[model samples]
Target: MASLIEDYALLSDLRTGALVSESGSVDWLCFPRFDSDAAFTALLGDSEHGRWLLAPEGAVDDCEPQHPARRSERRRAARAAGEEDPLQGEAEPDPAAEGRPVVVQRTYVDSTFVLRTLWKTPDGQALVTDFMPVGDRRASIVRRVEGLAGSVRMHQEISFRFGDGAVVPWVRRHEDQKSGDTSIVAVAGPDAVVLHGDRLPQGHDHRHIGDFIVSAGEAVDFELCWFPSHRHVPARIDAGASLQETVSYWKNWSKDIPQQESYHAVVKRSLLVLRALTHEATGGIVAAPTTSLPEDFCGERNWDYRFCWLRDAALTLEAMMTHGYEKEALNWRDWLLRAVAGDPDDLQIMYGVGGERRLPERNLDHLPGYEGSLPVRAGNGAVDQYQGDVVGEVLVALEKLRNMGGVEDHFSWPLQKKLLGYVEEHIDDKDHGIWEMRGDQKHFTHSRVMMWAAFDRGVRAVREHQLDGDAARWEELRDRLREEIMEHGYSEKEGTFTQTYDDAEVDASLLVIAQVGFIEYDDPKMLGTVARLERDLMDDAGLLLRYRTSSGKDGLSGAEHPFLACSFWLVEQYARSGRIDDARKLMDQLVGYSNGLGLLAEEYDTVDGRMAGNFPQAFSHLTLIRAADAINGHGQRAI
Candidate 1:
C-alpha cells in the first residue's frame, strides 16, 4: 500500500516531480511533464499498480518506534512528578518521523529540492539521496545510495505502470551502444523509460528486483530517463555532476529570495516549492503534481490537479513578485500570452503544460483512488467552465509585476485589453465561481468582486502607466460592478457578503474581500463576514473549510477537509485587521501542519489528523508566502 498523504516529500526538476515516502518508496511520479501519465502510480493504489521502493531489507516497521505515543507517555510521567514535559519547548519533531524508522531521517539538503534520507538498521546505516536534475531537455531522476556506516542490505524494486496503471510495459535488457553498459528498458506504445545504474536489478515476475549490500564508503547510482518509445534512449548523464549542479542551482536561486526575517525560513521554503511547481521551460505552474488525491478520502470528490490553472499560476506569480522575482513573472506572463492568445472567448480556466488545451477528464478504474477515493480522475473537467475571476487573477498578477518594475510589452498590454473585452462580453453570465462549483451556475460574489478588480486594474494601467486603453469605459465598468456587488452580493440580514447574488450562505472566499482591494480589511462588512465564517466555516481546530459542504453548493458527494489556503487567507485577513495575535497563532498552527519536510497538502483532515487532497499544493504554499508577507507588512496593498 502507499504511504499516508503526509508521509511523502516532493522532488521536482521544474518539469516533473516524484513523491518519496518515509519508507523510501517513490510512490508517485509523472514522466516528461507535470501532467504526463504516471509511471509510478502507487500513491493512489496498491504497490502492484506501480512504485519504486529502495529501502533496508526488512518490514517497514522494523526500525520505526511510535514516538508520538511515547512522547505522550513522557508527558504523563512528567506530570506525575508535577513537572512540565521537557520536550514541549523544543521545536516539533519531524512529522514523517516516528522516533526511528528504518528510514530514520528525511530532509531536503538545505533549500534545494534534493532529498536526503538516512536509514539505520541493526545491520548498519545507509543514506539515499534522491533528486531529479534540473535543466535537462528530457525528464530524468537520479537516486544515489551510499553506505554511511557498516554494511547494510538494501532491496530494490521497479514496476512500470503506464497509462495510469492500466497498461503494463514490455521490459527488456539492452546494451547502450555508446557506453556499452547494460540497461533495462520498459516500453509501452508511445512512452519509454531506460533505467541505468551501476547496480542494475535483474528481472523477476515482470519487475526488476534485486538485493545488494554496500559497505561503508561505497556508493551506487541509478538513473531513470523517460522518452518516446521509437527514439533511441538518451545518453547517460553524470550522476555526481548532476547532483552537484542541481544543488548549486537551488542554492543560487534561494540566495535572492528577498529576506523575510519573521518567517524567513518558511518564506524561502515556500518560494522553493513555488519554483518546483513552475515549468522551467514553459513557465506554466501546475496546481499540484498529483491527481485524485482526494479531499474526501474513499469518496467521489477526487479530481486531477496536474494541469495549470490560470488562477493558480497567476496567483503564484503574484506571490513570487512580492518577494522580488520578476523574471518568473515575466516568464509566466509570456506563457499566458501564448496560452490564451486567441479570442477571449476561447480562454480556459486551466491548461496542460506547454499550453495544450485539451485535457479530457477520465476515470482510472483499474487503480483504486487514494485511500479508496473512488473514480480516480485524470484531467480537470473545470477547464471548460466559465470562471469570471480567472481573467481578473491574471490581470492582478500582471499589475503586480508591473508595479515591481516589470515593463509590459505590446503583446501583454493588448492581451489584457482583449481579456477585459471578454469580461465585458460575459459580464452577466453565471459562472462556476472560483471554487468551480459543479452545481447550477450563480453570479458568485467572489467572481463579481474579481470582475471589479479586473476593470480596476485596467483603469489603473491606462491612467497610471499611460497604456493604451479606454480608461473612461473601464472606470465606468468598475464603478458599475462595485455598485452591483454592494447592492445584491451583500446581505443586509446576514451583515456580510453572501456566496452569490441573493444567496444567504457565507464562503471562506469572503475573507478575500480586502485581499483583492474590494474593501478595507477592517471594513465593517468584512469584519462581519469574518465573524460569520468563524461561526460556520471553522472546524474545532480553527482551520477554515472552503464552504459548507453540507449545503451541497458544490454538487459533490462527501465532505472535504479544511482547506489550508483558506486558513492562510484568514491569517492574512486577521493580520490586516490588526488581529496580530490571532494571525500569529493561526499561522503557527497552520505551518505546523506541514509534514516533516515542510511540505503541505491541499487540506488538513482535522478528524483524521492527517493531510488530505493533493501533496505540496501550490495554492497552500503561495498563500503561506502571502500570509507571511502580510504579517511582515511587506505585501502589496492589493494582494
Candidate 2:
C-alpha cells in the first residue's frame, strides 16, 4: 500500500514533479509535462503499478521503537496518568514495520526541495539525498547515497510502467564505453529513460532490483533521465555540481520575497510550492501534480487536478503579486491571452499546461486508487463546466498585477474588455457554481456576486487606471448586480446569503464577498452569513467543510472531509474583519493541519487525522499565503 498522503513530499524541476514518500519511494511522477501520463503511478496503486524505491533492505518506520521496553513503560505511565495518548487518532501501527531498517530522520535541505533522509540499521547508518535538478533538462532525478556512520546494507528497486502503469516496459542493460559504468534503459513506445549509476540494479521481469553495502566515507550516485525513445541517450551530469546548482537556483529565486513578519517560513515554503507547480515554459499553474488521489477515500469523489484551473491560476498569480512576483504574473497573463484568445464565448474553466483545451476525463480501470479508492481518473471533466466565477477570479488577480505596477498593453486591456463583454452577454445565465457542482445548474449566489465583481473591476480599470472602457455602462451593471444579489441571493428568514436563489443553505464561497470588494467583511449581513457557515460547515475537528454533502447538491455520493482552502478563506475573513484573535487562532490551527514539510492537501480527513484529496494543492497553499498576508496587514486590499 502507498504511504499516507502527508508522508509524501514533492520534488520539482519546474516542468514536472515527483512525489517521494518518507520511505524514500518515488511513487508518483509525470514526466515531460505536468499533464503528461504518469511514469510512476504507484501512488494510486501498488509498486507493481510503477515505483522507484531506494532504501535499506529491511526499512521500518523510525517512530516504531526497536527497543520497546521503555516505550511500553512510557505508554503505560501516560495511560495511568489519564493523559491523552500521543498516538491517539493515528492509524494502528503497521505490523510490517518489524525487522526493517529504521529512518533516523528525513527533511528537505532547507529552502529547497532537495531531500535528505538518514537511515540506521543494526549494523550501520546511511544517508540518502534526493533531488530533481532545477532546470528543465528533459526531466531528471538524481539520488545520492552516502555512508554516514558505518557499513549499511541498502536495497534499490525500479519498476518502470508507462501509460499510467498499463505498459510493461522493455529494459536493456549496457556498459558505458567511456567510463565503463553500467547503464540501464527502459523503453515503452515513445517514452524512454536512461539510468546512470555506479551501482546499477539488475533487470528481472520488467523490474530492476539491487542490494549493496556502503561503508563510511563511501558514496554512490544514481541519475535517471526521461527522453524520447527514438532519440540518442542524454549525456551524464555531475551529481554534486547539479545539486549545488539546484540549491542555488531555488535560494536565488526565493531571496527577493518581501521580508515577512508572520508565518515567515511557511509563507516562503508555500510560495515555493506554487513555483514548483507552475510550468516553466508556459506560465500555466497546475492545481496539483498527482491525479486520482481521493477526496472521499474509497469512494468516487476522486477527480484529476493536473490541469490548470483558471481560478486557481489567477489566485496563484495574486499570491505571487502580493510578494512582488511580477514576471511570473505577467507570464500567466500572456498565457491567458493565448488560451482564451479566439472567442470570448469559448472560454473554459481550465486548460492543459500549454493552454490546450478539450480535456476528456477518463478512468484507468486497471489500477486501483489510493487505498482502494477505485476509478482512478485522468484529465478533468470540470474543464467543460461553465463556471461563472472564473473570470472574476482572473480579473481580481490581474487587477492585483496592475496595482503592483504591471504595465498593461493593448492586448491585455482589450482582452479584459472582451471577458467583460462575455460576462455581460451571459449575466442572466444559470450555471455551475465555484465548486463545479455536477448537479442541475442553478443561479448560484457566489457566481452572481462574481458577476458583480467583474463589472466592478471594469469600472475600476476605467476610473483608476485611466484605461479605455465604458465606465458608465459598467457602473450601472455593477449597481444592478449588487441589488439583485441582496434581493434574490440572500434570505431574510435565514439571516444569511443562500447557496443559490432557490435554497436557504449557505455556501463557503460566500466568504469571498468582502474579498472581491462586494461588501464589508464585518457587515451584520455578512457576519450573519459567517455565523451560519460556522454552524453548518464546521466539522468535528474544527475545520470547515465546503458544504453538506448530505444535501445532495453536488450530485455525488459519499461525503468529503473538510476543505483546507475554505478554512483558509475563513481565516482571511477573520483577519480582515477585525477578528484578529479568531483569525490568529484559526490560522495557527489550520497551519497545524499541514504536514511536517508545510505541504497541504485539498482536504483534511479529521476522522483519520490525515490529509485527503490531492497532495500539495495549489488552492490550499495560495489561500495560506493570502491568509498570512491578511494577518500581517500586508494584504494591500482585497481585489
- Candidate 2 per-residue lDDT, tens place, 1-639, comes to 678889898999998999998888899988888889999998888889899999988673333442232233345457668887755565554433544577778888878999899988877889999999987465899999999887998999999889999998888886667776668988999999889988888887779999999999999999989999998777677999999999998999999988888898889999999999999889899999989888877789998999889999999998988888999999999999999999899999999999999899998999988877878989888888988888898998888888888889979999999999999999899998999899999899999999898898999999999999999999999899899999999899889998999588888999988888888888899999999999998987778898888999899999888889999999999888888898899999999988888899999877656788998999999999999999999334666
List ranges where model 1 is wrong by over 4 Å.
59-101, 634-639
Measured against the true structure, the TM-scores of the candidates, in listed sequence, are 0.93, 0.94
Error of 2 at 565 (Å): 0.7
Task: Please list the residue runs of candidate 2 whose C-alpha ends up more than 4 Å from where it truly belongs after superposition.
Answer: 60-99, 634-636
Single out the weakest 10-residue window by summed lDDT for candidate 2. Answer: 61-70
lDDT of 1: 0.87
Assess each prediction's global lDDT (C-alpha) against the native: 0.87, 0.88
What local lDDT does model 1 show for residue 79?
A: 62
**Best TM-score goes to which candidate?**
2
How many residue pairs of model 1 clash at the backbone? 0
